[model samples]
Target: MNARIPTDLSSSLKAEEDSNHSDNPSFDTVLAARLSRRGLLRGGAGTVGTVVLGGMGLTACGGGDDPAPTTPPAPGTPTETLLGFGAVAKSLADMVVVPAGYTASVLYALGDPLNAGTAAYKNDGTDTGFENRAGDHHDGMEWFGLDAAGKASATATARGLLAMNHEATTDELRSSFFLHANGGTTTLPRPAAEVDKETAIHGVSIVEVQQAAGKWTTVQNSAFNHRLTCLSDNIQLNGPARGNALMVTKYSTTGVQTRGTLNNCGTGKTPWGSFVTGEENWAGYFTRASTDDTARGGATAKSVVSLKRYGRNAGSRSRHGWETGGADDKYARWNVGQSGASLDGSDDYRNELNTFGYIVEMDAYDKTQMPRKRTALGRFAHESAAFGKPVVGQPLAVYMGDDSRGEYIYKFVSTKTWVAADANPANRITTGDSYLDAGKLYVAKFASDGSGSWVELAMSNPLISGYATYAFADQADVLVNARLAADAVGATKMDRPEWCSTNVNNGEIYFTLTNNSNRAIDSASMPPDSANPRVYEDTKGASTSKGNVNGHILRVKEGAAGNAALVFTWDVYVFGAESGAAAGSVNLSSLTSDQDFSSPDGLAFSPSTGILWIQTDDGAYTDVTNCMMLAALPGTVGDGAKKTLSYTKADTTTLSVDTYVGQAPTADKLKRFLVGPKSCEITGMCETPDGKAMFINIQHPGETTAMADIADPTKYASQWPSNAGYGAGKRPRSATIVITKTDGGRIGS
Candidate 1:
């Protein structure tokens, strides 16, 4: 009765890295004759010193003559050290855990109705109207405060709207309330009902939440409560790639619109108050027949090259096969192959694949507004976007990372200088169009000397135009085929870049380069660099894997050039390893029982207390402990010393390398905060403006449950957030947990 479980089914396997290579540019030593960290404090402070005073416009800056504030900012108010709550013990129980004086409660969960008319979730795979309920697999999210009139308020802390992306569905055995029946997979064209149900649960959810008596709960029937699914008809196409010929399809003859968003992963908050949802792993959701690659006209030789590069090669099967259902356009649009009569691909759904993989902007406070795909930001498995604090009359900058093995990191700089009046705008999407719609996208190229450059991907660049293979038409083509363009310009392929977080007090950026198995597969393979400096075998239970299984975090300092800088210094902040690993080679952080972790994924910086939070999405270390979240007080890039790494391969070959490693973590410096249940990933977090409450997401519990015990309630892999002493059920659900201090004080204070 159960479909065969895929042995290769993985949540994080996006792409192979060795396919692309970067011409590592030569540069001088990072810390040699250049101005040292101490020299900056004396005279050359520039943007680095100004940012350390509380970012671009977040705090006031004065000259030397200006006196300091009468009193220092409060301990929990974005400028001081974090020394409030004791570290929580790491746990594997099927429940949310917190520090001693904090409480964790489920605010909203999968299948929970947002409006009054919808029925509660049945949790039996028979429920309907998922478009009106909270979606599944909550990931990237942001908090938008609501004013007294229920409009978008940037200041209100107690009441606001939470917009979260439902990344993807769960495995059937691991989760009982999954979308389809009989193991949730079928080769025969999927049933239309199952397809519709699945589509309804894979987008963004906006729910109104408020705190009363120190506990937060959703506001039932609130006008702000809404769900934007993969089936929603109001998603509009915008920016350079809006009306391109490649985007034309039967659904949109003018290529001006698309139905929904897919694989919404990491997210960002726009300066003008909007939720920016990034599309990750969306290429796996379409079907392309084998013969389509040989077709003429719209299916040219360039199409074949681009499709294969993007992992949508000929004969590729859709992830869930919604295109295989009944022949209606609703089902047919999921197919992205040549079956149309028109030459420009307007008569069929061949171009439907071009409509996705974008950064979508939605007004969380306003439900009736349509979501716009800001294509100028460039696509390619977007993980998260972080904007530098805006400054008046200065260019706005946004940072991004492509979440695939051997992928490149990117940044976008707007042509127009920011005007302070636009911060509190009447229409946010209009403001977004002014800035995000017209920007120059650039890919990063990291050098061996601990410095890096941002290579512009515009058509005007000779490197992109002179590339002989793929044809470059305009800016639209460059943005649409961003990965190819990045490859063309020789951007440095990273070790699976994921969530990016920036300090509130300074513009220094930190991102997690989650483990990559392809780093050292053979003698000819790309070896470890200073940024990704590990190659070893990490065996969990019976499964064994080599390379950088326990990933590391990369820290970048923008220096005097600021966010728009082309050259910046970089170093490895910390390396994830077991407590018993070799000191200088593997266990660089010198982790102890309470601080050791593996494969760091989700990352965020507290705007209130300047603390860095690290979460895990790891299979490499699951046997030793469940996935967890940790908090640390970060120093700077050069605070660490350089060390050498050595590894012995299976073929009896030995390799040695050197990398910069951070200071050893003490009990007070880095410690585990909370741990999730069995087979779950801890991701997507946001906090109230007052820093009193925090919201974190737990995704895909029991994902490791075997297919044999799926139907038995007692044998279910995990009964979390529910049976973990919160709700009542045996089925596991991905839900958001709210953590607040029990004494009504600031969190971590």
Candidate 2:
């Protein structure tokens, strides 16, 4: 998610580093066998797409060929057509592009002052006071509206607070070069000042913004404006894993407190009106010496197993080399190696990595409230935590995904039932404690029949209690090492599940499976399965990419219309592809030029209209177009039928798979809404209660520029925000853009 380019590391390689190499059966194989048993696999094929299972109608990868009956709208629900605006054409421009009749304006940008005392940003790589300025790489966000009285108002339209994740900064040669004068230092013993600034920008920011005279601007000195950086104090730890022996670090001897959040990627708006963010890719921030295993009791030790399972193996280099900055606690905390005499890890930062990888909750309206890490959700490369629709007297359920190749999807059901009054509780953090602290964490296991079951990850589960691969000492261990527990229970591996969004209309959940490089048609270790069944090569100019090059969206409907249901039905909602891709296989969704997109990442359903907004962070298709955002009207899980795809191998033999595909989206139901600036990712979206105003983040524009060329504006991949006449200099900055209809009507209408 950072999308930051380093000299020795490419984005694709960084993604591959966290891949799941377990031997769990893939959904592809399961779906193939299920279709074969149903007598649906066609004998000879280049790519056969029709396969009727039971009474469901089937069709190839062609949209509008077979229309299925859709679930009628709920009582009094809006019956308007889904996408109302004309599609925005693809662009390679250095500025944001939206449909005609819409105006997009920058609302916030990196280095912008959050307080009146902070000096205005010059955008010349010499800015400081990041703790009081907008951070880099604005990501997954939520809007908290405020009424005229300056109090919380769920339906307010003219004023609100925007809480977003500043995931990471652009880094290369051991420095976040974009934030320093003359590109900073690129060698070992990184300057403490440079490290300080970098650390101050890698967390979350909550800033107030208001509309006045038809223009929107951030309230620089508003009381609601606050920034939580890696050096911020008083972030508490909650849930079952809190105070666990494995979590004891030098900074928190009791394991109940830790310093700032890092790599805050996808975000969630809690049912109790709190802001929750997922710490993603945090493992790469800590340096583990090669002798860590030896010091901690060798290869089979629990600490070693846990560290490796979490993708922090020995000798792993820190992403920005912050640990080499000196002996101060601020710098030393980045080192997770064993250096102290205490065996329980309370004397050093050996357990510092465990403090992160959680769903952190904070009351955006109250800056005094300390953010709390909800550990019951089970730690991994968390992308987002999307809660199911709350029904009074029922247990609350939250869905999450581990954003890595071959990882599993997880769900947490709170033991306590929801209460309507708690929606506007006296203290939001306490309300979060009631539901998020105690829960049953379950991992998904998809079967071949388009049905899946949630496998509990508690010690009571025989598979977990008896797991020989990694012995689980207690529930805390199970939650801390959730990946291994899911592996033990035979959970189905997904293709890099990124963000989960719940449809307000029907409560069905949608997950964006961002593309995976590890997938292959002939790989013995990781082959294409039914659920992840695309294996083809895509060439953008001379650079060729393969293995599910364009990701797809998957949706699931919980059984019995209950969020806590253990069983569910699922289907591939849409397969991302170029409109020109070969039909039936590569272009399974039959996407037209107006509907094609790759690497679906940020996903959120408008609570006002139930329209699902999808944003992308793609590399595979950047040669054709910059990352984009699309608006879609999705149907329920069983609305479509099953289809079988055949991939030809190098031996000329074909491997066939049967997969459940959702009804194809017509142009009216799905269309491109916006395209980002060059070399940037379009992520994080939120809307006002009236659906008249929309906000999206353009992250890391001009990110492809070489590190050595930081001083040359001519060589930058993009100059946007600046080119658009926004900031002080030519350097590009990640910023939030607000879009509204010039006709004064609801957006997309």
Q: How accurate is candidate 1 locally (lDDT)?
A: 0.73
Off by over 4 Å in 2: 2-7, 10-19, 29-81, 648-654
Expressed as tens digits, the lDDT of each residue in 305-400 for candidate 2 is: 888877778887787889988889989999999999987888899999888889999999998888899999998888888999999999999999
Model 1 TM-score, 2 decimals: 0.88
Clashing pairs in 1: 78-608
RMSD of each: 9.6, 8.0
Tens-digit per-residue lDDT, 672-705, candidate 1: 7777777788898899887878898888777666
Clashes of 2: 3
Clash list (residue pairs), candidate 2 = 27-530, 28-529, 28-530
Show the lowest summed lDDT stretch of 10 residues, model 2. 53-62
Question: Which candidate has the highest TM-score of all?
Answer: 2
Which prediction has the highest lDDT against the true structure?
Answer: 2
